[model samples]
Target: MASALSEATSFVPDEATVDRFYEISGGNPLLLRALLEDCAAAQDRETDVLDPCVGGLPGSALTHAVTTCLNRSGQLAVTVAEGLAVLGEAPDSALLARLCGLARFSAMQGLRVLRAAGVVTDLGFRHPVVRTVVLENMVPERRRELHRVAARLCYLEGAESSQIAPHLAAAARVDDPWGVGVLRDAAEEALVEDRDLLAIDYLELAHAFCVDPRQRADIRIRSAVVRQRNDPFAAQRAADELLGMLRAGQLTPAQSLATADVFSGCRRIDGVNEALAALRGPGDGAPDGPAGRAAAVIEYCPPWPGFAPGTRNPALEWEGRSAQRGEEGGTAAEELLRRTVLTDSTLATVGNAVRCLVYTGRPAAARHWVDVFVREAERRGADGWYAMFAGIRAELALMTGDLPAAERYAREGLERLPKQKLGTLAGGLVATQVLALTRMGEYEAGARLFEQPVPEDLFTSEHGLTYLCARGCYNLVTNRLSSALNDFLAIGRRVRDWGIDQPQWIPWRGEAAEALLRLGETTEAEQLLSEQLSLLPAGHERVRGVTLRLFSQTVEVRRRPALLVRAVALLQSAGDRLQLAQALGELAESYCWLGEDGRAWAALSRARGLAEECGAEHLREALLLHQGPIRSEGARADGSYEDQLARAVAQEVVSNQWDGGWRATLSNSEKRVAALAAGGHTNRDISSQLHITVSTVEQHLTRIYRKLRIRGRDQLPVDLQFCDGPTTSTPCRTLP
Candidate 1:
């Protein structure tokens, strides 16, 4: 059939175009030939009939073909074809019945007649071109009327709001009360599904038709709230429109409070405060209501710094209040926030309450709130709220060192984000995922996320802090020290400038100190750590545990052995196994340096076990190097200590050989240097042997010691003799 069509046109279509033709013609040879003849006839004098654009076939050819096909069927069939064309090629039998005001059986017969005539396929109009041709010939008013019918049909069929919205949008008289009401309902449904932009469109259409001033104001407010996630400029316009309504006294007191809530949630702090003040004015009497009390709580105790010009400075006030009221005041506020979470609170109120609970060191309660919100959102099918709550849970899990839970929550949250309309909420989920992967030692995966471009608007929101911190940590692990230092420092500067230096939220100072330490700036590292330590409240045990661990790393191992001990205890108490493993490893090294072999062995064993359990590969490798071989007297029966040591070295050799373990620990260059040094070669001799400078040899040896956790050349492992030997006379035996 394709060959006959090709012969008729004297030109062969590309594979894709041929496939498209087959799809449109439903493999009917006559239809295929007709389409080819049309293409051939429409070709310009110099144009190929099967050129990339299919020789620019005119719409008239399609119109003629569709008209001819429809003429072969009864009027009922023609009407069903038009209905399918109006619905754009996929109208079901029931929708056809609804559109044509016929019985379902009659609609099915009509479809069968059209199908037999080759004007319709199992899917709908045999081809999209056929539908376009039929619709193009439709009169303007008749097309609008058909669209209105289609919208009603979709609504009655329980189609998705996104699916029904476009039909209503295309109706000619969208201001009709029925259309407006449907639009409003569709908008609310879209919002619940997190189709915020879709919701905004429906609300705008409904607002245009709304006759009542209060209803119009309500639509404008709803549009602004949905627009807050995306389209900030549009949101601001809607907010301004609502503010105009407020000034004109068109909005009820409840509506005014709702507007203020929207403004505050969107970070329009000045507008929210203005509305709240108006509601609280002496003659207003609105201040005695529940809305007024909620507004008062926000005004009196803002959770974070406001992002508006001329807004009250809450940071200083919060600091003074913290000092005066202390933990008791925090507990009272937490209880109040908890009660709010249990009530019918807005998204803004719930989010602020969760943040306050976390900030007050009550994560268990925060988790409770998050779980409750997630259940409610799922029950209501509010995908946006579910994503937001899951993101919060991810961040909470990451803070408490629950890497698996953090990754799980982050992935689930990210999947819920609207593909085309991700905002700061999505950014927060990405940050949480990256942080979790990095902490779990999946640096390559985390680095891939770092390479992806972040959204421009994300930096303007609070989630920006999470992104910067995650990026900094990724850089630190990938050995990009300068970049890591700059990012962490930028976070500090931003926190100070914004007057929202909540260390528990970002912990930028502790991160920057680690970067500084890696850069070999010991003095600056100590200063940063000391500053962070002083700022942290003495009772925030989890953060304090982290700060103490960083502090222990800054000073000499022997000078702060006790600090490492304290850090290990705190981390264990907090159940941060990853950091606890790190602290225990450091403590083992200190114990070895202090000549406490038994204590060193115990600490190293515990560290190795924890590292293995947590999948901390780097820590496991380091601990393996620090741990000396275990002695077993039964191996030789009459064994002296030397025989036991020899047995241990043999066991180590077998283990290393099995896993390629020794090679995994040292780089090729370090291996070469260690082998030569173990063969009793001087640094200069090894440098000469390896054709490198003496300083390079020394550097390699230094790295080998660090990798193997040995103090000097004399303590080099017997396995070094097996790495790349020079047939040295020095025996591969235990040191006496």
Candidate 2:
């Protein structure tokens, strides 16, 4: 049959080409013959007609052949074929007949002819290409009306919502309530299956066709909420409609809840209170339901609402109600965290969870939950949710002293949600970024972000408290003491006014005290540190560690080492290497002031190592300033590099023996310099058959300071050997 068609078109087809005939035509010999002849006559020889990906039955010859074959087979078969194309696969015979405007028995006879031609099996196309050809050949208006007919027939026959959605999606709206209801139900089901994009498509279709104004508004609200799962900003297209419906109280209980979710996801704090009102208006139930969940979130809303909560922060009462509010809300937030993760975890749920953990200073727990939120948000493409969670992860890293991780997560989060779209909630991200940069000694980078305008309401949000603290810390480090003090005081006042007492997480008082100490206001610094200490619980080692270290600065020199020792232990137990390094540095100073040379060197050595491990270049430089302090009282504090080397030589001459190890980090030539600078003998040989070369001590000392200064003074492991001059042929003033 293929050969005959090929001959007619003046082309010879091989056996392999005949195989393509079976594949595309589904073994229908008549269809195959026509397709083969069409292929031979085609102008584009490079186009493979057999492969649907390259080309298939969408042109004039294939359409005419299909029409001719169906017409000769009988018009009844053509009717059934068209109906099957509209109704999709395996539709009921009665449904197909009704969609085609034909009787059932007549449609069945047409279906039989289609089966005999191998054009259909089980009342659907024998091949996808066959269906594609028929569907493409269909007239546009006819195809649309048939889809409407198919949808109506499915509805009349009591088909499932899932079964009806596809037809409704393809058909034009006829103002049918049943169609709207099916689309809505199918959209809900699609959400449960995690097909968020599909859910949005269905809701959009339902909204377009819904006749009732309120129904259409409600559909729009649902759509905006669903859209948040992919991109929160995308949902803002209908912001006016959604917010207007919300303000007018036209939404039902369920729609109101969805509206609340949309508002929260978009960072519209102004709308949160109104949504909360609608949620609690008449249908609110137990505190664990949707209303309660939202209430728990609103309870800690930054710029925390007045006494009753969710009132949008107009609180001037300034009562000492912080302790009470913190206890109640902390319990509520912790209780509700696990119940609302992932699918049930809205923006409110995730925010409340992280805030609660931070309130208690449980960084490990906070990191675990934020990680959970991040993975699920990324997988679902929920940009706003992922951004917030990622920022929270960065904040946790900051608290726990993983400075590098803190910087990485914060930069990534800011990238995920650009600062322009970040709104007031961007406070957390900016805070994390600035603080991480401040600690890493990148002041210029941190300053650039400060010039970028953030939302004015940041100072009023809970996130603003953190941002203020970060800014103040930057000020303190950079020597702007007054500005640093003011920022810290602002945080202190807001945290108290807003009724959130989280000494462990909010270290404003400790930070302010440090700034005061630097300004020589010793009395004020000690008072603030004491107040923080009196209020802080013993269980919070992280904040206590930081507070203890800062407080040590104001104490007498004799008492400072004890306080610093405790700070070091506290920070070490809390697993905050960054804070631990700071505490160790302070302790080393205390040991120096007490004239304990050995103890001071040990503390300085450990502190330098910790600073290096934390990648704190600022801390390491600070450690270098302490080398003179840890020396003996008679040792030259203002020693030049050469003078310091002279002292080391004097120690070697008086002792006549030395056994401190040089680390393996030194090169062979550098080791020779160290031994030569030591002892100053006329001649000497240590373990490696190397004689001392004591020329130019200053030159050798310079390299030594740069490399091993951070590891403490003149100390090496048991790796390098040292020998001394002897009066009895020990090479002192006598060459060996």
Candidate 3:
């Protein structure tokens, strides 16, 4: 049977044999023996080697290739082999020394034996495989010692820390001194991948093995950051452990600072504030040497839940006076700037500290730091962080009310986002666009974009409720009343569910109430508006003032003079231009409704001025549209004209069935003219009705067409389409 198998193999290797060769090479001793027997049998013949790729190379061939590379580099010597003796993977020179220093020479010698026997060989003549095999056999402590050594050597060789970290980590696991450093490098790489889970593992390893409390603190802080999103409370717990070390004098100030930052990042506002307080506690000995400067401002990283400038935080203040350090002129900004200056030129630290600068309302300082981050990101070919910083700058512009600049910056930032991050950040970009468009009075376009669905994940952020609320307001502005109401109701439920009755001056909530009022739901609208108004913080006087202005608009139609006067008076006190314009527009309509034409015109002119001041072209347009009701020549001066006008407005309202106020203005004669007009009738055709001459009919028709602003009678179709009710096409009957 052996003879038959040998003859069957012949001198040529077949495709079928490739798997057996790889398997034997992979660690099958029986398969290796069989393959060797076949190779010996075919040695004398001109063999057709079946090796087509790495997959096809035989065990013998791989052994020869690895040995040849090592031989050619003259790295098959005892010195090189001894260095790789204890590793299961590539070991830098330092790892070899550490193993030797630890009296683990026997483990290292095993690798040398494999090298000599050609059982293990160098990858790129570096003896990588030999080292890996030897190290695999060592105890965890010895392996960790070797890994610590290798990490240092790799760092000296300018190798990528992330690329070399795994091997070093094994060495560190065996009580290696350099484990902490290796873990730091690995955790950083994992963070870049957003693989916080892996990062936390490495950090814990560093914490357990690192002798230096400061180093342990550094790793623990990063681990806490990794855990923050998945389990915020746990992350805070981990950070608190580090803080305890600092308080016990077991950690340095720099380490304590890092731990405090992790707390802030997790939004553990109370914990961060408490840590800061302890850091600045009485006789908390100052940090020694260069770290002392950081000690003076250890409490200045700005506690979480930062306010936009000029905003009050009564609840936060009441919670604790000392913890309320995010108030105006807080040292957080200054200390952050100082640390930012101390940051190394590395992309990592520069990017890290600058992020705080932006968050602390020091964007200009951040701008300088961003320049450094941009250069490094470009060198690394990573656009993600660069684009994020650009977006931050755009937000700063928005806060300053530099709308044109904000738009430009936001657009440019969108262009810089990498494709991988597009889904995550796209919603914010779309929101920025919507804000710009709304500010520019492009309501229709904004409404269309707002209707686009947002990702469910985005709803978990701080801005989630605000984004949903904005969608409601956008719908309201574009006349999508039912949709607006639905969005408003949804927002109400979510906010109530979250127990968040007091959102900041988002304005969307107020706008939602206004929409309800516009839809003629006065009672419900008043209640909602009152709820929002009640929550308006003391510092947000502008918003509260605006809410009062909105209150004056209620019942303006029924009690025009009284409501109009209140609206105007509210505008006179601490007027926001946008609010003033809205009030004046309402006041003008009230005057017109009460037949006080002179007062109405004057009020309209005042509204136009404020609209111009506020750059609100849409409000200006609304005021112009309302002018039709007052100046319409078709509206007769006769007593019977009143009933006719009311009936016509009612029919127009019913026809549209969407706009109640519009229906109220449509007169009977107007509806008559509209039905005939929609029936494709001429002015003369409509003229014959109601016993009027064609000349008078023509004159009245001209007035009718102008009042509705139709180009001609044909375009002014009756909304109901027929005298009886709505018809699919023109009615077969003439106007009565």
lDDT of 2 at 519: 95
Candidate 3's C-alpha runs over 4 A off are 1-149, 152-182, 185-418, 421-429, 439-453, 496-500, 503-509, 555-736
Candidate 2 lDDT tens digits, 124-219: 875665666667767888888888878888888888888788788777565476888899999988878878788888888888878787789878
Measured by TM-score, how close is model 3 to the native structure?
0.44
Give residue 295's lDDT in candidate 3 (0 to 100).
Answer: 26
TM-score of each: 0.56, 0.65, 0.44
Clash count for candidate 3 is: 23
Candidate lDDT (C-alpha), each = 0.66, 0.65, 0.50
- Judged by whole-model lDDT over C-alpha atoms, candidate 2 comes out at 0.65
Tens digits of per-residue lDDT for model 3 on 30-139? 32444454455455455445321222133434344443434443433433443455334454434554545533454445445444444454411222333443334346
Backbone clashes in candidate 1 total: 0
Backbone Cα, N, C clashes tallied per candidate: 0, 4, 23
For model 3 the local lDDT of residue 714 reads 32
On the 0 to 100 scale, the lDDT of residue 726 in model 3 is 22
User: On a 0 to 1 TM-score scale, where does candidate 1 land against the true structure?
Assistant: 0.56
Identify the candidate with maximal lDDT.
1
